[model samples]
Target: MELLNLPGNIIETVVRMLVNQRKTEEIKIRRLNFVQCLEDVLNLRATCVRLLEIVNNTRLKFPCVVNFSWKDPELNFDLHCFINFMANDTNWRFETVRFRKTLFHVEETNSGLLSIMQKNASLFAKSVARLNFDLPLGSNSIVLNVLNLLDWLRRESLKAGGQISFCIKDPFFSNWEAVLLVDHLSIRGSLRRQFDIFIHLVGSQKFPNLSQLDLPDIIFPVAKLCLFRNLHALSICNLELPENEHIPLHSTQITALLLSYAELESDEVECFSNVLCQCFPRLVYLSFKNTYRTTFSDDDNLCLPETCTTVETYSHMLFYFKKCQSIRYFNLQDYYPALDRKIFVKQLLTTLGTRTALMSVRFCGKELTRTDFMSAVENIVEECHSLDVLSVDCCLLDTQDSLNDQTEIDLSKIVRGEKILPIDGQESEAMLKLKDLCRDKQLKLLIMGKTVLYKSTADVRLMGEINKLEDLYKWNLKRGCVQWLSLEN
Candidate 1:
């Protein structure tokens, strides 16, 4: 009855049967725990010679989705696992196969994953796209040694007419690799020393292809904006940028800028306005919340009105936004709770006047009009010529009228050129207004978070929009997915 002593074929047969059994509804919940089943397989792989052979025969089959973690130094990936991954069937899911680790194993053998990746460099270089690394500070020294492998993969990927999305989820400037090897880097955590290194790398054009830079922890110095030459998207959440200084950027490739929880000082509004006008001419998507350089209260009700008082602050922000004529989407996420809807409507017209290039307006979990929001819709159609998409989190808007407000949306209908009509007594005034706008603008509407919950799964709607099914499949399959989208219509 010792499983490890069994022959390779026998082990494979048993494992297959067990996997099948665990998948069944009869056994999924009560019969076998998931962790225990995985543990059983891991033990089998480590202790049994047979199971490794079985892995070899199967062409080293790997799931399209990969999520590997290193909890401790003892965990290892042997030669078998590395060889298995090199199987010609290596296609990965574009949903960011994450490799995260905290502790660095210093026994000179190198961490199991690094060893495997190094050993199988040629095989891995040809496969991966969209690599996201979220390693802790302690792993910096170990990661430094593997810089050559990363650089090789990056260089090879570019030569194949493909770009590697190397994401670094921390601020660790151990050397120049922090900026040199990353496409998407989030400057965060214990960044006192790392900050200076980051400035040096960026200021010196270390990573010419770095497209996205996110800073949630540091109140970054305003002068650093000029450092990024190829940045396409920048996100700075909850930090206050100094006002009275007109910071300029060197990159026209910049597209999306998200500062959801940013605090705007009174004097800083004009400075931002100037930057919006002068620095970002090709800006496409912009998101910001109105917070006058102060923190909100713990009480929900008390926090909102204080932020909404800054009507003039938002007006200037909108005025500056006029220079960003190429913008396609705008998002305002719960920054204003109570405001005179008339002023908001007028300001919308004034700022967005005749700039019809916008495609979507997403009010994510924000409070909109309670009564007649349709007033803005008429102006949007007349002025903003190409507006088609309007997504709002209508759950927050409260009205005394017994209008049946929508709770969920069907993405199937939205993509199919069909209209989503409101249910009887369920249609709020805002919904009715949006319906009119959709009719006039010929728009596609979605209730936020309802349509395509994860951005990775957003291909569901686009699949229907594509001219042929085969083409869609061929396209997504390259990224390691097969039938991830439900097509059982």
Candidate 2:
């Protein structure tokens, strides 16, 4: 083969080929690094595509986490290309794919990206098992994008026999177009058809292998309760009944239910209580925050049949407490600040007392005196004998003096499980006695105060005493305190 002398151009061509190969290698390396930088910025989808492209071109095996960010134009383009390539390529096999914390923001009302997603829906449904569908708070266009993506995913999963865990953050922010999209899929004529779609997706045997469903801050109508069977966890926010409507008890197989901003009429509390007790019998964790108006009949002094049951008064919460006895963890937010603290505490104690399985309690509210707070703690400690964790952020002891500076308020010693001496002549002994009780119980006390004087261990005995001193000096040095605090646990 080397009999004839090679031409000068032929030699140059071989040299040029070698140089171009090196340049291609360098380019691939640079592109890979760039994709990694994007991943560091939480741009996973782009990184995946870029890596995939490099791998396909060079036959190189690269292992990296794929994160998707909707904000980057190049990243979005790369993602769309990657999806198209994956759909066409049969050799690519992903060990794991995660779509975590990617907030979608569509610039226009119509989402062209959704059509691309729908076109390659099977590849995405097969590759991705964990997906987080978080959209910007007010982006109506993103909702349509989500609905289209979800609908495509649902259809694809049904055909492929694959399961997906989907999380929707703030579903109520969706615009009319998104709502209509859900309605169209649900085949239900009502505007509130998304709930039906969600239930249908959850309950359908066609997609029986679906594992996790997270719906944050979404209110479900009464008809949608049956769709939650076999779910591992369900988080609902702003749970409310339509006016003049009542939901009966229906059992679900969900393990966890986070109920926030439960808007129910006073008369409807009993019905709500019954529904909770009967429906979510297997629920292990239950969380609730805030309340709505209660409907009370004036003439008969009873609940209207169309409204919630007549258990709307504060006394009715006890009924809920009794019904939710099987729940292991309860996080409650007090709705009524003006109600008698002693009476409320007593009712709570009586209701939760029967639940020996209770393990944790989180209480948040205002207008709770130190005594009132202690009473509630004691009630939980006594009733939920198995309780391991207790978090309380309730305001203790109302002060009449309106000091312009909140720093002038003497709260340091009081919060550090220290005995608060009466600044005035009234009830000094009671304060001292309460301190002794807190110390005896080994309660972790967190007090927000202006000045906190360091005390020796010999002075007081408590499990954890965290005093957040709000004075100027403390505020300046607060960073150090925060660092120390972070290191403590």
Candidate 3:
């Protein structure tokens, strides 16, 4: 019998199975074949009115957590229909619900649409364990509607111990008290006035559960530090540190910190380092990333001179490594002048040598020559006893040879000892020595070269880590650096 002649219940079951089957084999050929077959079946839906009605009317149920991003232009089905399907039940669960500006098209607030959205929000509040909701940025009318809907969602989610992450671009919310419900806040203001206004409005208010903050291109909130007693992660990019004011100390709860494109006077670097050691004594992850003046435009006066990031910066930054003694992962990507790469790396290795908890260390710099990197690895092998992983950017080698003809080298073949990469004399010498050191020390060495190279205990571990990184960071083997702490042995 033709599929169109099937009974209504059978057709409904097929439609629901097609929409809700979340598990699939990861093999490329199998994934492609499954996608093609699914596409053909979906296309057949357009030819049959019954199938379309069943798809729109089916009460879909997802067994696993759902991640719905409403702005995807490639979405094959109508999002409004899916939202209605989700709202059909009051117990639909979700992992993340990201609503971007393109998700909505109405110029003015429609009470009917807003009411439907709020119903979905109520369902999300009860079922979603964690909420990383990014508000839609658009016209004032729609923005207000989304904010009000999210406010209701936040209040209900908070009752169930759910966390909310807000990336605020505009500070003109009707209710400032709504911030008290936020658990993670990211302030994205391009202008200084906007940043100041946001701080002025919310800085003094206490957040009982706010634990993660991202303040980019803004000044440090000196007074508000005490308000967030549970802050665990902070990312400050392109921020100017206060010159003479004494930065207060935070509790030993902060574990992850990122300081990128930071501006500070030559004299303040040391004091800031001392303050960080005292503030976050249990720091487990630290990242220091800076680009020298060469990358800055001529009109960019904010670029600190090469002298600002001298040996003093390294000494001061390394002070935290020595004092904390709890760092597990460290990443440094910077261009330095007036400081020898060898000396800088030697000091870093020496400081981390005694850190028994250190698991991964990554270094990225164009100025670091092959010889300098080899020497750094030798020092790490001699010093760091508990270190399990070492990652380095191959751009530091200054080699003109390409390891693979194609853009993607088969990492599975490399891990299986079935592939060999040809290298230049100087590069090969350093890499061979580096590999020998890692092998002897029983460590995993990851080279972010033409492609990534690493030894995995099994093919599953490498594939799993790759998939996880790709899903979270949109990372691939050809990308910049891998977060080794996310790797499983």
Scored by lDDT, the top model is: 3
* Model 3 alpha-carbon miss at residue 149, Å: 2.7
The count of backbone overlaps in candidate 1 is 7
In candidate 3, where is summed lDDT lowest over 10 consecutive residues?
A: 303-312
Over 4 Å off in model 2, which ranges?
1-131, 136-207, 214-229, 237-251, 261-278, 288-290, 293-319, 322-328, 343-351, 354-389, 395-489
Give per-residue CA lDDT, model 2, range 205-307, as digits (tens). 4334433444453676545666645555555564455355454545677554555455555566655655555665664444444444332333212211221
Error of 3 at 61 (Å): 12
* lDDT value, candidate 3, whole model: 0.47
Sort every candidate by TM-score, greatest first. 3, 1, 2
> Which has the greatest TM-score?
3
TM-score of each: 0.53, 0.42, 0.56
RMSD, one per candidate, in order: 13.2, 17.5, 11.1
lDDT of each: 0.43, 0.39, 0.47
Tens-place lDDT per residue, model 1, 174-288, is 5555346567776566665577876786777788878888776666565566778688877776434444454433334566666645565444555555455445556644555
Alpha-carbon shift of residue 395 in model 3 (angstroms): 6.9
- Candidate with the larger lDDT of 1 and 3: 3
